[model samples]
Target: MTTGSQRTRTVLHLPCLGPDAVPLERAVAAVLGYARGRRWLRFRSPGRPEGRWVRVPAFGWARFDAHPPSTGPDADVLIAEGLHGRLDRTGWHAVHDALVGLAPVVEAVGARAAGRPFWELPADEFSVLDEPGTVGALLRHLGQEAGPHPAHVLAALHHRHPDLVPHLTPTTRRALLPHVEEGDSGVEAVVHRELRANAGAFAELEAAVAAVVGDARPGRLRLHDVLLWLTTTLRLAHAVELGEHVAG
Candidate 1:
């Protein structure tokens, strides 16, 4: 189904970052708590979707082609766990491809990906397990292309306004401190400079979001913290999605 006529369900991708990934089992449980019984589904590259966790009525499931689903292209939402760095090509392809897809995919952007130099769009969503309202809002935005992660949006705001960074840090920045202080020249300058350069990408992203989801920017993101913190998960989500897009 195309975005206009497709069903809307919030999906989360969980990629295996590594042995040190802070236990996704715990993360999922936390997400469930945040969701408060909203229909949460999981899937993998079964084309037929044969293998999946079946426990609740709302518990839809998938079998990812990658260790986690964030790397996949067909995911409506991804919830991988890596944060140490950007996902591999497999996952990146999946996310880029999924962005091309008619549906919206939500992946967990890792902290490393967030803090690391980015000449590209931000995908950071590593873990907002602590914030239900924020996560809930993000679920709403999953259908949109969201070219820039929520973090990017905040970064733009931060670049223009520093005062908001403090209140925004909790849900936006997560645990990573700015490579330099918020207003420092290099980190601060690079982020905003890239943001300006990314006008086209952001436009494309917004177009994607608007095409699929209309003009409602529901979710919130920080340009550099939460995403990188759980960097491994993001990589994992994209890997899963890439296979789906390619096979399809």
Candidate 2:
């Protein structure tokens, strides 16, 4: 069994993803290129090409903003919103309620940090992870309410405080940090360490994305989330092909 001190140390000392892990120019090119492809529309009926492909007037990060009931401007609104595309009404409610219920705890923790970005926080602040009824309890509660997969919980937290919490998808998490166990109490700590470790890369990515998107640039955390999600799931080759097609 892992002791409290051991877990704390694990969180504090978690390894970072080096700068080379994500190539700068290549990643930017891939994302911009992929955006040119039409968005996928699923068809509930049996055949019919399975779904229709629709042109997205605004692609890439802009698409995130274009959709109504925009996910942001308020953390609570973001948390209450569920992944309607992926989850049924029941699943959505469970995620929504579970995340909304944890608002107090999340707010309390955010209060302590005084709105500082997680990347800027010192190791000592992360001690909250080891506190008896804080982060550990939050994780347990999330597990109970949201069921086993942690992506929704982490995603909700990310929306609430993009700077403090990194958004996670199972594919991105596994591709980026395969060794880190999901559902572990120390998971957030590990994510914190990883983000801090690769802060420079993410910052560079943010700049690149900003340059491409102009005024509509998304937050660094969101860009990081999108980058990981796309690169890991779509594969760089497909992204390049899409980019080439767009350029042509």
Candidate 3:
């Protein structure tokens, strides 16, 4: 039932940004650029003699949890249903188990948030992220208690309230908030500022995605998460191949 143009649009289109946003186009172009770069690297790289090309896979969003699976439930599904689920089956059990203690915390924060998305909160209202004994602090503490992989705590929180939180992976922080130190009181606020400043761009992404995918559009924060994750990952890959550092 899909036409050729529609198929092409689906392939080139990244539903995370509005069609008019330059970043959206750039994101698509980045994928294409990666493909071309990989081909060039295959034929011309110091490591070409070492079978390095065999390790590089085609660039695509499937590498990340940008969207829920079409046939099976993902962590987001379990979180939405008020249940605990691990981001990784083997490693995240402790984080999920530790998360149980935070049910009261989640309830209190949800009540205070009153169903408003994080971007919609006024500046003064958003300052809770910087305060002691608040959601931000509790989350930080939870990360510490959970041990090893602190970033998964943020992932759990984002899955719980996709609109109220942005997923903060090490890669995302390094790529987007290099100056904001881990556990910094203002980390959440800084991320919020980034998202708020580009609200229009995300809105366009949301609209474009809705136009193409109908009702299955992911949350706006998830779209931002995916866009940053995808691009950062690609950059990291390219850097690794060249034996260069990925710029923070």
- RMSD for all candidates, in order, please: 19.1, 9.8, 10.1
lDDT of 3 at 40: 28
**Which candidate number maximizes lDDT?**
2
Error of 1 at 119 (Å): 14
Candidate 3, pairs of clashing residues: 17-204, 17-205, 18-204, 18-205
* lDDT scores of the candidates, listed in order: 0.29, 0.53, 0.50
Better of 1 and 2 by lDDT: 2
Of 2 and 3, the candidate ahead on lDDT is 2
- For model 1, what is the alpha-carbon lDDT of residue 183? 33
Rank by TM-score, highest first.
Answer: 2, 3, 1
Task: Kindly list the per-residue Cα lDDT of model 1 for residues 1-248, writing each as its tens digit.
Answer: 22422212222121211224323223222222222223335655647567564333221112111123233333322332122124456655544454454232222322223433233323222123433323223432332343434332222222222211211222322322233243322232233333344344333333333333232321212222222222423432332233233223
Instruction: Please list the residue runs of candidate 3 whose C-alpha ends up more than 4 Å from where it truly belongs after superposition.
Output: 1-22, 27-90, 125-130, 133-146, 179-184, 213-215, 235-248
Which stretch of 10 consecutive residues in model 2 shows the poorest summed lDDT? 7-16
Candidate 1 ranges with C-alpha deviation above 4 Å: 1-190, 218-248
From the highest lDDT down, the ranking of the candidates is 2, 3, 1
Cα shift from native, residue 144, model 2 (Å): 6.5
Ten residues in sequence with the least summed lDDT for candidate 3: 239-248
Q: Distance (Å) between predicted and true CA of 14, model 2?
A: 13
Error of 2 at 205 (Å): 2.0
